[model samples]
Target: MSELTQLSPQPLWQIFAKICSIPHPSYHEEALAAHILHWAQEKGLHAERDAVGNVLLRKPATPGYEKRQPVVLQAHLDMVPQKNSDTIHDFATDPIQPYVDADWVKARGTTLGADNGIGMASALAVLADDSVQHGPLEVLLTMTEETGMAGAFGLQPGWLQAEILINTDSEEEGEIYMGCAGGVDFKTILPLEREAVPAGYQPLKLTIKGLKGGHSGADIHLGLANANKLLARFLSLHGQKLDIRLLDLNGGTLRNAIPREAFATLALPQENAESLHALAQEYLAVIKAELAAVEKKLAIQIEPATSDAQALTKGCGDRFIALLNAMPNGVIRMSDDVKGVVETSLNVGVVSTEADRAHIRCLIRSLIDSGKEDVVGTLSALGRLAGAETIAKGSYPGWKPDANSPVMHIVRETYQKLFNKTPNIQVIHAGLECGLFKKPYPQMDMVSIGPTITGPHSPDEQVHIKSVGQYWILLTALLKAIPEKN
Candidate 1:
């Protein structure tokens, strides 16, 4: 209830809390952007915005550090729009209610947006720190990064002049991320038909809920259950036997977040109602036991539908389930070079059945362009086989790691001096804007690092409060270690 700035010195939490108080969900960031610009002006720094609403703040080098090369600190300004079905928070315009739970800061019943808000907070924190020695600095806060990398894509040529970019977008705290996967979002549409309700039948709805869903890219290889897949499996096993006619189906919402819950409606023989209820309970136990560790809270529900006379069209129900069962989800391949890293993956993230056609959104990710294309090809082929029209959008390239990067070396050395251990350097399976930023600044050297964050892309997302202090320590040290140009 009290204002965010009332909490001081802990600038990371303060700035993050301030950010939370504003509604900056993808494409609706006017008030949040104005907040950012107002803050930048208060610091007496020059802030500029491009036509697409991306903000850039420039700070001249400290007196003795002017000779060093300028560095750009980058983070997306917008967060992914996601919330628990029961939560009343609105993305278009509502404050995020966050609480500290021992080690991490989390929001109530919704995503905390730590994915890049922490990055933005860290940048603003650094800009505000008077003691941290550094050369010239430029902070570029982009808009609408989660829905797509449109904020990065919308940048006109020469918007950022720095050749070195520090992206604070990765989730893990200690590891230094040098490269990341490229990805694309594709959707398929299928025709729908209607039929009269069957006689001597009762309408019923089945649901799968309470899974601990996460970022599809970061959590794909874990073999977590997909709600749509579980629903289809249930239908495949008991549908025909129960004389069930599935009418409506839906699951997931975002292309990047794992589907947490799904439900379907169907008409079934009234005589089998008790048997169906028993089956739902049995299946809940079986699935909970199967995914006990990964998805401890998984649940299943079976309830009578509001209307017993309504039934799904025979044509639409058959094709919809068939399409879901055939669609690919989860890790497609393991990295050949990075040992444990996922090389390629696909997620059938969102599906909606409409009156005329079904719309399905699939996300494909890979560390290489060729591998990404192969996954896309496989998805397209499957969609074609299912008689669905497919559309691919939101494509972004991979950012290849540079082992010999000067800024990377500086960060590594500074980290060792501060923490007394070499930082783990690796390529991530998720997408980062550095991939597209490189297309413009071909010579740009980039690395992504961030405080520890967990359950990103889901309502449980949080940031480690203590890690922010250490992250700031390492960041300032790296800035001081940068080499001065002749």
Candidate 2:
């Protein structure tokens, strides 16, 4: 048996192990979907797929609970594909090699996929376990949630019959999330003008790596370093004192992840090369001191390069660097309603330059619609000032908390009775599909809960071993405690 199969909560861990063996990265879930369909068929459960690739599995009520109302167990089917720059694993072909790390389960140099994978496993285990008592159950597995809410947005009005939704996507084990922040993607594109490399100039590459880039929503409040922003500051600050031309610059991979690495190629007068090297070292020392506590390994490396490529015109380079330095990133506002919770934030997640264009992508999130709009407007103004065109897309609404929700009471009561402690009833800054699901089913009551998952969307991702068992118990108890429909 695999190491995961030996874990406590055998059914859930085993299912998760199987899931890891298949490739289910966002927008590439066909193989995993087929596997799930085959598993449902083998288990003789009624399963169907929606037009947007969402999978729904139905299990009849237990013998004595037939009169109780049906419940929907929801989780996204896709996982964010993130790996260390030096890791050789492929999300498509290689299975996540998860191993026990003391009290947690982590993968080898890549994301563990526990953000929603464990939730998916729990639902599947419930369907397979005849020993567990519960009412009628519907497992709604959505697709491509990491990239965008494509599956949630495409959900039809009648896609689900259950009014009570239990979303198994939240990261904390002892927290029940009733509301989440809404988000929009802001992008800016600037036309680039490249000029022939001036005579007596030499090319050099500057790279910034080792920043602890993480989930833009969950970790933005931690004050981590953004490599893109740092690089821009260095370039802009030094450009004013040196004769240099930017050849190319790029950083980050996903729009929802804080950039951890950045690279820039520049051409400068041969006489200034040694001075540039000294300045880079000086800047590195300054930045290291600024982020020493949070980003210990943060580094700035400069090396010689042999290239004859043209560089961006001085005007364009200066403008681009200035705009980046001025971009708003990290936490914008803290929640006044919920103590210690982030109400609004933005992440400058990606920046890249092509032959004739430079692009900057950011993800903005806020608890209130007005707050979201304000941030978008701010980004637009910045883009306009830099002679770039700005566009916002993939906007989704936030889920509003229902303080007097009947289902919340039941879940709270059940959790306390089982553990002799209260779970934290809270709202998260991260985006959840429960927000989008509310559009078609406005009356649906939703709560998001899951085992403890740390460092999601990064190679350091891990899931607590003991929390999964507690989560399973709580889930089962809540299912059995659901009241009958009037």
Candidate 3:
């Protein structure tokens, strides 16, 4: 065990350390689910797995609180598997090496998985600690939340018997999230026609790197650069002048993450090679100035490239670049109801050119259904104009904030009494499972809270040590404060 297991909340950190030793990347959570099931059973609690692999555990209330309402602790079991290109760790086999850095705990060369891992650990700690006073408790560890709300979507009616659910997935320590935005996946595919490269053409590689990419939902309002869009912009601005013929294009990975790197290779007449390099440098300067504040380390590199002597036909190349450049990205609209919430946004998260086609995938999020449909319609129109096929998938609903929740009142009062300050109760622009859970369990009252986690879904992910202690205190206190059943 590393020093993280020795942190102030030993029980919580200890379980988190064990979690780091297991590989639980999205869509591959069976092992971790089994591990948690075994642990819960060893503690003498009733444990079982749902058809979709969600783990459910039940524990009786403390001696005096058995008559109070039964509360549910909810968290996802999977983590986003992300790492730097050069990191030598494998999410399928290797354990995340976590260590302490001042007031935070971070992983070595990979995402720390603290986003939901810390939440899971806190739940386990609560279950194992017999001293904490609480009513009957149910733990729900859902699967594949990062990729989609698969577990929540497949959750059967009556699977959980609780009136109040405390989701341990929110990132900020002193804030509580009562609602979140809904989202859908959008993909565009452009057929490619390849031909032998012109006899006098030379291949040039263009790369955009070092941008501070982050969660497309959580960080969209931060003004961070999207590398995929940047690369497409560069190609559109200079391709015609350089007589560029695209060979290959690739960038980004997950639909929920803002792209940090992009690369494209193209063929141009030998006479225009020098001009291409000069224009690249000029455009780099402009882009740098535009993203100077948030993306200080943004970089653009141009170099000679050698590959198969084939390139996209001129017509296809022009259409592809034009469509990519025209797609809307980043924040689309801000909420008029909430002071600092993003209402609608989209991220061109992944782009790739394959043997017969070039593809682009985007994640569109909005608080209103009409806003989501508007963005989808716009993309569909662009795809038609570009002669590309478009498809939308993995759509999920948004959690609407409740202004009259008794559980919210209990949590707020508990937090104020503990910290001597009011917590920030707000809605988030990101997706959460609470929305999907509401479909089957319409009567369930829900709120999300967690320790302070930053740079989630990226290699820079970390959890503040001090906040873990505070989060634990607040959760346990909230449990004790659940009012007696009427």
Q: 370-396, model 2: which lDDT tens digit per residue?
A: 988999999999999999999999999
TM-scores for all predictions: 0.96, 0.98, 0.98
- Expressed as tens digits, the lDDT of each residue in 239-358 for candidate 1 is 777777877788998889899999888788899888888888888888888988799878898876775333567656766787788777898889898889999998888878766677
lDDT of 2 at 231: 95
Q: Enumerate residue pairs that collide in model 2.
A: none
lDDT (Cα, tens digit) per residue for candidate 3, span 387-410: 999998888999999989888888
Whole-model lDDT for model 2 versus the true structure?
Answer: 0.91
TM-score of 2: 0.98
Native-to-model Cα distance after best TM-score fit, residue 372 in candidate 3, in Å: 0.6
Clashes (N, CA, C under 3 Å) per candidate:
0, 0, 0
Could you tell me the TM-score of candidate 3? 0.98
Clashing pairs in 1: none
